[model samples]
Structure formats: C-alpha cells, structure tokens
Target: MPKDTILVVDDSPTEQRLVAAALSLQGYRVITAADGEEAIEKAAKELPRLIVLDVVMPKKNGFQVCRQLKTTAATQNIKVLLLTSKSQDSDKFWGMKQGADAYMTKPFTDGDLVANITKLI
Candidate 1:
C-alpha cells in the first residue's frame, strides 16, 4: 500500500513528538504544527490524508480549524481526529459538531491511536 501522510497539531512539544513517533513507527509520513493557524496552512498545503488535532491551541483552536476545514470545499474531505486532553462529554459533542471525524483523549495508548488512524486513513 502507498504511505499516507498525517498532520499532527499540538502546542506541546512532547505531545507532538510522541504522536509523530508513534505514527512514524507505523510507516506514516508525519508532519506537525505547533498552533492552529499553522495547522490550517499546512493542511491546505500538504493535504495530508488525516489530521490529529488538539483542542486548545494558540492563534486558533482545533474546533475552529476543524470547522473551517470541513466547511471549505478544498479541504473538507480531509479526516480530522481531535486528540485532546479535554475529556468532557460536551467537548466531544462540540468537536463532532465542528466536523471532527473522531474524538480521542490524551494519555491514549499507541494501540488506540493506531487503530483510530487505521480506521480513518
């Protein structure tokens, strides 16, 4: 199978590296962004198959980015997975409402992460 690229958006360097490494180990081409604005720019330019987004970010938030990406025709088809520390039911609801294809919490196992990525991309 052809390798797929995944964009991981997070303000925390540790989280960013952790996710990137996990995805890379699974043979994915991992790209990263430190903020939501950068995420949007990279998403539009790189056109990755999937984006792992964080809810709280600078410049823009994951929900905002997800909404814009989903509403914009050019980038709407890219699958968005909200991987965040927010575990509230309301947050998950809001994320899904904002067009996130999947909502996952932080402290996630590599197994679950890969499973979600496999299902999405």
Candidate 2:
C-alpha cells in the first residue's frame, strides 16, 4: 500500500522541518510549503490526504487557504488540520468555520500530532 501523503505548511523553517520529520518518522510521505499560496497550489495539484496548515503566513493565512480549499471543487474534499500557535477559543472557532478537520496548537507533542492525524485519515 502507498504511504499516506501529508502536506505540512508553515512559515517557519524549523517548525516545518520538525513537523515533517515527525510525520516522516511515522511512515507518512510528507511534502511541504513555506507559505499559504504555495500550500494552495500544492494542495490542488498533489491532493494530499491532509494539510497541516499554519495560521499566520505571508501571501495568505491558514483561514484564507482553508476557506478557499473548502470552496474549490478540486480541493474541497481534502482534509485540513490547522496547526498554529493561535490558541484562543475564537481562533479555534474560526478554524472550524473555515472547514478544518482539526485544529492543533504549536508546542505540541509528536504523539498528539500523530494521534490527530490518525483520527483524521
């Protein structure tokens, strides 16, 4: 069977690498985008099983990307996991409203990240 592909989007290189490494360690095929525009393009083209998106980014934010993805026919079905430092309840609410399958904050454990992705895919 093919390994599940996950797109990890974050503006910070360290954060992106860390997330990618964790997912890769768990046998996932990981791709990455440094900002939201690239993320949108990759999502439409790659159709990854899930997107790990960061809320604050140049070109666009996670909410904007998520909203666009959810509304666009080609990418609408792709699951999105908002992985951001935004921990406010309102931020979580907005993420869900934008059609995220799950919202996870930064400074998270690899175990929690894997568990969330497991539940989603």
**What do the candidate models score in CA lDDT, each in turn?**
0.96, 0.96
Q: List the candidate 2 regions with Cα displacement exceeding 4 Å.
A: none
Alpha-carbon runs more than 4 Å astray in model 1: none
Worst 10 residues of 2 by lDDT: 1-10
lDDT of candidate model 2 versus the reference: 0.96
lDDT (tens digit, per residue) of candidate 1 on 1-121: 5389999999999999999999999999999999999999999999999999999999999999999999999899999999999999999999999999999999899999999989987
Across 27-100, the per-residue lDDT of candidate 2 in tens digits comes to: 99999999999999999999999999999999999999999999999999999999999999999999999999
For every model in order, what is the number of clashing pairs?
Answer: 0, 0
Q: Clashes in model 1: which pairs? A: none
> TM-score, each model?
0.97, 0.98
